[model samples]
Target: MPSTPGAGQSVPGTAVPGPGPAWFGAVMGTGGLSTLLQLHADAVPGFATGAVVMLVLGWVMLIGLGSGFARSVARDPQEWSRSVRDATMVPLWGMVSMGLLAVGSATFVVTEARAPSLASVAFGVDAALWGAGTVLGLATALGFAVWLISRRPAHPLPTWALPMVPPMVSATAGGVIARQVKSEAIRSILVGACVVCFVVALVLGVAVIVLAYHHAWFRTPVPVALSTTTWIPLGIIGQSAAAAQVLSGPSLAGLARVYSAVVLVAGAGLGAYAVFVTVRGFVARMPFNTGWWAMAYPLSTCGLGSYFLGWQWASLLTVAVLIAIWLLCAVASVRAIAAPRHA
Candidate 1:
């Protein structure tokens, strides 16, 4: 029930309280890193150990979210809704969905038991969580979109891409789950659902990114605290590409290849820009806060995208990009963990 400083309040050298959604970045970061490591488990030694660490980190963030929400509600019942309406904070809902997806993915990757019952149980649990998270994520995205359209807030930030990104997370997670299903009919249905989710996220995320760009160009530089959010659009691209790769069917195979190729280039470009902006902000002594977690999921997804493309095209450059992204995510996650905590 402890409260933290809101975003936009932190100054260099000052200890700042964290925001409710701050832990969300940890969820995204750990979850995304876990997924990336899971994908490259063959090449990477100790993949299980790395996944376990991320799973534990994800659980901690989940607990933090529960506690943070409880505290926020206790302080003001209306605060959560108000935050959802806030352009910068609305993306926390996507964190909730992505966090569930991350943990579920880690479970599938690390649980090595071959017994039918155990595998069934694990898949069942993962599927249930994915269903719930997807529902919540979609609802949050839709509700926020309606509110945004009606309210038409000025100076929108790239953080607006947050709510839209969750369904894509669900799509990626669902695609993973779909691969395990025995029924072709069921698998096809699941794959189709993932495709729909991908489209929704892509369309909405791009719109938000465009608005954020206009705001930044015409209005002002984005607040330093939110510099990390510029990477979110890359997350959308990366995650969608990952989902398409997983859900590639006879119908989607060609589209998936094209999607992966395009996103690889786009992700690399956006990632470079994000890195430059983030480094500049850090050099300017941007205060450490939960917002730094924003770097986690995006970088992780870009890595995922690169890995997918590498496999599809047998491209060494994409493989190298994946490695570099993994390292960068690791560094960012460690720094986020070591950041000053709110009392």
Candidate 2:
């Protein structure tokens, strides 16, 4: 079931893209775009931006991130240890599950506002996709959750890490419910899932701000500043914000805008840092080796967030930038694959 051919072919998961870091970009990208689409649909009449964004994000995930990971695995089958393989596989399914939700959501949106005739069929298709995707994603996540619990991190656990599990579990539960439900039940379950995703994202938000502060206080700039790690979490935070907006409706309009603004600000600030790093680092004769491209993960995250947080102009800008970065990363990864193994 893994999409990446080379990654999971020989090994049960070799052709399957590693769910671990490979998922970080796709998950955050799709989620953020969906969130923004939902938000725009509510605030403006006949807004098509969200739908387009979702489609584009989906395509990018499949082509750029998915293919990139596949190549990475193909280069070295042993890189994906059994433990890491399990960890990555869970999220790969999670992405599939999310894709189903997206189709369903899009169907509902289009039917309600645009064409009633297409509604029934699309809705049904949505259900089927969501169901299939959910089953796969859930099985993977559950398996990984068990694996994670049994295993220990290399160092002492951070306080913030503790809260991550509950929200994640809650979101997965919501995915299951969303896939199985019908009528009014579907909306209710999705709303719940969005809430959990946002909660998880909020915790992540706090962590990012903390990291930014830590760097500032220590006067030691963390390297890979512009790469995917720093800005992508904000994108997830933005998606959660947009999801909260959609679920809550007009009654929470003010709160929704505030959340969106916060996401936009966070994204912009982090994006600036990334840009500064890229420029400064490049001009100072810093190596732009294959390793530097890894930042594409976080850059994609920030780009996704930019689009989702109602920052339309910025979102478009980031998407373009992220696409370029992603391509560069892909080339680099593939080159690494062709390079002779040192050992």
Candidate 3:
């Protein structure tokens, strides 16, 4: 099993790798942009338009990639199985579920802003996506952990956290939908589900994160190809914080919020270091792989988590940073289209 992701993928020129892990990250990031915009649209009306545009674009990419993967698999039936065995690629499969959750949440947020009357419809979309995403997310988190443990694993890297993140995404997104639904019975079930996923993701995710830390601290610097994935850990921190805060039901809400606050503040210290490392990476001209999309969705979670904490100023700063990341990704995409690269 390879330690590195191997190839940058022909994101524009090929179909199979076009649906690569980071490709889905683009969908996640775009949908995440919509969530950020909807959160602040009331304070700055200009964000509303971008919110809707991003919402639509996110959905388009999601559906487009879904179809692309379908066609690719139909043409080469072994592709899915191949990806599953590819150590460098398998962990990143969590992006599939993350993309679904991102788009689902964005759908709810945009509808809440522009079409209140359509909340029911939005709920349907959100709930369906949540269900699908949760199943896939659980599978990725649990299945990958088993796969890693059952075998002699390669050295740990930040990307190891990728497969662990979807449930955290699920926990946060599930909390949002749980509050939206009116049925007490369903709400109770959803909150329980959210809590279960939160704990599952948190325990396993943290262990992997700590081991990854030990690897970076005691071993070698993370290779340039996977450097962007340093931001990936933010997804776990931010989503877990956001999930804890958003969890409802009298029995869960208060305690969850308290836990959320503590993690949110502590995560900020590491978040700052992640940002510094990312900046220093620029001196080496960080390459634009799909992994760079980490700046989009995972980083946005930092802002989303802050907003849930009612830290508007902190959320705004995170948003400003993500906007720049978005532009850089756009430029990178255009450049990649013009000239594709391989490992």
Candidate 4:
């Protein structure tokens, strides 16, 4: 029997006070959309305006939600640790990092035409933020990995892939910066670092994906709130492909091309599977939650990867894939923003 609300008790539809780290998902989703718009600004009319709006919104959410999250964690240390250990929440660190990267990408696009110096400053700031985020992200990923090994939680969800995805975010952002920066030495360092970051994230992420798939296959179904996480592996593959292409210098160009092709094909296959899974889950009336924001960044990154490969190969298919990705991302963003009142 369902329990009824008692006197003075919070009812099902009541607004809850305080904020959670999941709020960072807004920053991640909006920022990612902003970056995608910036990337395609030349092709899409009014993309600049859209990117700026989304970028500003992302920053607002970051500042507001970040402040609330910090306060909540400060007030409840044990709860903070528990969240850190949670497979779903652990990815908030990556979302924060990706938000910084998205802001940087938008800054670059918006300012490069009128204020080159400001764009450079923004790039520097982005690099600094990426550095800090990468360190924190890696530490958190390691901690979660250790906990998983020791605690051996049952029926781990695909969201476990969350903790391992951040370094790839670093790789993508760093690779972009490296390609644009003036100094050759700095470019080489950035490229090398991004390559290493990509490798680390790919290896670890693959392990997590395998485990999550095993659990989903043999154990229990994924919780509705986390259905969107099925796309995370696509994000990992897509980011890796993009980063590899950017970091592909003359010496490694051949290798990079091969790797990019492999990952692109892999990502496309997985994206198809994710689309089916997501549709079925949504049809089942998956309740709105912060996890819905999971739909944005992964799809954006996958689109980027498709663009990279298609451009390199001079294929018309890239245009079609990118258009589909853009539409999906738009839908996902709208859904995330209009999510239910319940946390």
Candidate 5:
């Protein structure tokens, strides 16, 4: 997933010549920022415009990055299998589905304009992307689980949770599409699918996170390069909260509220710790890699839960933190492009 050459002794996720799936993190993160800004649109009207711009940016990134990755796969079909076998890079496969889901969900929130003329088109687009993302997400989750069990990775990396989080992304994204679907029968099916996806993601993510924490504590210190992934757990936590909150209307409101409340409390604490570690790593000169983009979606997802819970301040605070990280990542990604060795 790194921007390095295909053949290299650098870290597994360090770099490759063509665009890797991890590059889709740009789209995933941009969509997250757009959604977070939209959450603050009520308090700051100007944020709505920014949200639209972010959505457009995400779309552009999806197109460019998707093409590049597709090209790489076409040119060298073995690269896909190579990446799958590379433990460090395998987790990034989840980003491919999640990136698509990000744009799909944001299409409704930011790009739709909510005009009557656009509803049908937006619905079609969201449904198509949601279907594609959800299916791909399921495959990624299963594929990663298979790899984990058979290979039995000797040490746990926080990025190990990356592959498990896409189903949660699917769950939350499906809730958005459910809102747009007109038929009650179809909506019910979507809701059920969301719940199922949430459970799959949460259960699998918990196992990975536990192992990651255990490794972080009882094993050796996490590499400075991988420090950002320490924050990856927050991605599932916040996404689960958002999925529950979004399900409140169609499901049990009180139960959903209570679940979201508990997850939010946990997210607040974990998020604080994640931010500290990220800053420490940055101060210690963590080089710019595709891994740096790892922080964006997880941090931005915390805002989703906060906004859904009507915690305006908490949501906006996440936006502030995400903005800072985004600025650094934006600059670093460009630098990485200019010099892959730095990646």
Candidate 6:
């Protein structure tokens, strides 16, 4: 068998180079954007208009950019089996993501631009669609986790990371109930679900990034591989947005905002780190690879970070940042497609 990255010297019968963690990470990473977008619209009244526009723009950036690299990486004949699975599922999630963008954007649009009744209908539909998408997304995450743990030979990573499924599912359920059921009696129930899912997701995302960082920084002898660290900003940005929504409670909200401040500040620090990494990459003249997509992910996180900060100027700035990323992704997609394959 060909040697795989992180291949098991861990156990017999265990498969090496399982796609589970990577796949799960991708799905959850996508949701980080989805939920954060919604949270932005929800928290900032009247800002929904801008939120919808930016959300669509961000979606375009992610899909167009992600598809490009996914295609490049999938082209390797050695990657055939994994590529097949990823290709099929990616499109499925893409459709779902697009549907989500559409519904979510429309929710904000109709709510703001149209009649209250119209907005209500849109919200109802949005709830259903968001709930279903959330559930499916969570399932995908769980599936990835399962795939990770199934390595007949054990990998050192914990199987619980795979359990990101439950939080996603719970969150979706909360969204659904919050939308569909009008009863105040159920409001508390739904709220609990939403909070649980969101909280669990936040913690898990942070955990993954931290673990990846530890592995890359401390465990590995080599300079921490940049690819593994790219997604850290996503969690940092996401946690900030989640923190903003928690502000409804005196104790919780106060604490949440404080926590969010820490994340925002950390996000700034990481943003600097990313720039340093990029400049270093340029100076070192690292070999070109699809891995450059890592740069864009952090940029997107920066956009999300700005969105979470909720300042009028900050949100607008983030939209501008998102637009820039969107443009970069478009260019990258074209290059990735036109360039000849080399591994």
Q: What is the TM-score of each candidate against the true structure?
A: 0.82, 0.54, 0.91, 0.81, 0.91, 0.58
| Model 4 misplaced regions, further than 4 Å | 1-18, 74-82, 85-88, 113-117, 180-185, 312-343
Q: Give the count of colliding residue pairs in each prediction.
A: 1, 16, 0, 0, 6, 3
| C-alpha lDDT of residue 61 in model 5 | 90
* lDDT of candidate 3 over 262-330, digit per residue (tens): 887878876776677767766677656676777678788889988987889888888888888888887
Q: Across residues 1-343, which tens digit of lDDT does each residue of candidate 2 receive? A: 2222121112321222333333433433343344334435655554356555555555465456546656766787765464246453343344444444544445455444456777667566655655564455445545544554576322211111212322332343244345445667766768665465556445654553555546543655534322222333333444444454444556877886686677667566656764665566556644233224334434433443454445667655655565566556556444544453532
Per-residue error for 337 in candidate 3, Å, reads: 2.1
Candidate 1 accuracy as lDDT: 0.68
All models: lDDT?
Answer: 0.68, 0.45, 0.79, 0.65, 0.79, 0.44
Q: lDDT score, residue 57, model 4?
A: 79
- In candidate 6, what are the lDDT values of residues 38-126, reduced to their tens digit? 44555556545554554455455445545654565666654444433552232223223323433443454435443566766766656
Q: Per-residue alpha-carbon lDDT of model 1 for 162-224, expressed as tens digits?
A: 778888888888998988989999998998888888888888888888897787768887666
Model 2 weakest lDDT span, ten residues long = 154-163
Cα RMSDs, all models: 4.3, 8.3, 3.2, 5.8, 3.0, 8.4
Better of 4 and 6 by lDDT: 4
lDDT of 5: 0.79
Instruction: Please rank every candidate by lDDT, starting with the best.
Output: 3, 5, 1, 4, 2, 6
Candidate 5 per-residue C-alpha lDDT over 1-343 given as tens digits, one digit per residue, 9 for 90 to 100: 2222221114534442357676777788998998788767878768888888888898889888878777888998987777777755665668888888888888777656535577678678877888898888888888888878997867776777887888998998899888877899999999999999999999999999889878877886666666777777898998998998887674588888788889889777766766777778789887666777778998888889888877888889889888888888889777767775544
Candidate 3 vs 4: which has more TM-score = 3
Which stretch of 10 consecutive residues in model 6 shows the poorest summed lDDT? 1-10
